[model samples]
Target: MGTFVNNAWYVAAWGNEVRRELLPRTLLGQQILLYRKENGEAVALVDRCPHKLAPLSLGELKGDSVQCGYHGLTFDCSGTCIRVPGQRNIPTEAQVRAFPVMEKYNAIWVWMGDPEQADTTAIIDVPHYGDPGWGLVDGQYLHFKSNYLNITDNLVDPAHTSYVHKNTIGNAAGEEVGVKVEQSDSHVLAYRWINDAPQVPLVERMGKLAGNVDRWQYYYLHLPSISYVDFGCIPVGTEPTEANKDRGFRSFSFNFLTPETESTTHYFWLHLRNYHPDDPQASDDVARLMNQTFEEDATLLEFIQREQERTGVREYARIAIDNAPLRIRRQIERLQSKEQSAEAAAMDCEAETAIR
Candidate 1:
């Protein structure tokens, strides 16, 4: 089991994955059972039964409560013990821990931290989800053996795409256009400028966009667990340098990477855009093609994780293009420092209060 850093939220699963039936999931190394009540409300509780430590997931769902398969112990969504078959009354001490859970943008998010601090404010804002104009596509969920921090670093490093995904989205011979990186207390953004070049085979044949074009890609890391990529494209005839100011981009993608454990993560993504083929079937085909591109990324990352484990190494030397990852690591270290300071202050307060 891994230790969970308090005051963080994790993506448990897709909202659609949890139904009336109990669904077992592990987050931050804690086993949990999720289910929907009769009124369709989502609930999360520790998977262990208080009586015999039996997994509650294997138990049956009865109304808004779950019955332990071992001894018929029943618990409500809040982890309050409701019944013990053959007992005159349920013991007041019998209870299990329950975490705060919410369904947002088709994903179920759980607060794996202190219950008192769990609130909607902790969830990262995704503005594109409710917009009807943009065509939405389902993202992929994958498990990796590497630490969550490594995955975060990977996302922030745009240069890796060129080499790792060369067959897919990389630009093998593309120029190393300059990048602008900015970091604030809560967020980090990396902007990459791709100068004019002949379209790679994948983009030339499949992208369906023509003419001299320059691409500006911006990655925004919004603290804790969310990152979004904004892609901008300028046509051949347009002023390439001024395209970004002219709002030339028509597409954006947001990826919410949540840690299930130090060694595993859940990547929930939403691709939003207005560009689509006129033919309905063609649009579907395009969506499928785009999905396959992401699958390629997932497959590669999984292999990378396996290799990292076998080698037992840490800290890969970085290049100039890895500015995003460098910025993210600093941000994470800052947040962890703030957390420790806050905990120390609280401990001091408690000691003083007791003295009083």
Candidate 2:
């Protein structure tokens, strides 16, 4: 029902959210218990106890193990059965599946599919993060009831900002501006050039310039369920001489949409730059602005998903702007097909090997 292939990283939560106390979080419709060890290493395990199906999150947290409240069954960080109360011997089969997890850039990512396929190679690279000169900002998570594909579609179309986000970052001038789009194997990049446009509400102004202003926007829909947007401004000053002009602004944001089920998604995000990571006041302001934008998108997508479900429409018409979403869906389909073919081939090889 959902497109969680065998080898992608899904953001579970912010690194700060998981503490010593075991917390229960739902991802891909599966409830999970998360906590950190005494040494501050985070661990994730299936929340349900194998013995009685009781939630492990409701149990007690020891130094490095979680004890199920129902039967005092204790499990370690690796999901291994460490202790069984009042029992002389522990069965070799008594264990819960442990998911591989890692923390990067202040967020925790979990592998939900095949353990053998999971690799650190799949983690996305954020070039601007930790760059000495650029500022880094803290990001937040948002929960949505819409299909993840719809969200990817929305990010690719900057044209919708003028209408859908009219009160926020949308400006009348943006709609009138000319845009050029280019395509690649994994992404679509669009740029808009505006000349002497008037400053509008909700949009950040880079001040008036005599020459043209370059606004670059790029969207990348990575396989499985990750998407990113890069937006920035390059201002050309009024004077013919380039002596007094200020350096322009640049920023990048990413969305990791982990499907909780067929109709639900967990949206994790990180807002980053080369300069802002240590500036508390600036980071707080940026966080507030980014949260507002996410709220707007989440509200609209939720309503759209509900309507589509109610109507039971199979084929909905799309416009030219929907190109990125269509491209992403095609890529996902290809990956799924390839995986199935590989599995079938492996099975056939095994059959022959057995006969020999």
- Against the unseen true structure, what C-alpha lDDT does each candidate score? 0.72, 0.72
Q: Each model's number of backbone clashes? A: 1, 9
Candidate with maximal lDDT: 2
User: How far does residue 131 in candidate 1 sit from its true spot (Å)?
Assistant: 2.7
The reply for model 1, stretches above 4 Å from the true place, is: 1-5, 173-175, 200-208, 237-249, 277-291, 303-312, 340-356
Q: Give a tens-digit lDDT track for model 1, residues 1-356.
A: 23235577777888789899999987767898999999988999999998889999999999999999999999988999989899878787799999998888888888877688888886877655656555566544656555666667666666666666665455754446666788887788877767675554445544546765676667787777677777656665566554443345345667777777676776777666555523465446545655565566667666777777778665467678777777777777776777778888989999999999
As for candidate 1, its clashing pairs are 28-260
Q: Which tens-of-lDDT digit does each residue in 1-356 have in candidate 2?
A: 34546557788888999999988888777898889889988899999988889999989998899999999999988888988999878888779989999899888889877688888777888866777666666557888888887777777777777677665556566776554556565455544544455433322532323334444456666667777766554554344222222235456778888887777888888776432446776567667777788889989988888988899872478766666667777777776677778888989999999999
TM-score of candidate 2 against the unseen true structure: 0.85
**Candidate 2 ranges beyond 4 A from true positions:** 176-196, 199-212, 236-246, 273-280, 339-356
TM-score per model over all chains: 0.85, 0.85
Instruction: Give the Cα-based TM-score of candidate 1 against the true structure.
Output: 0.85
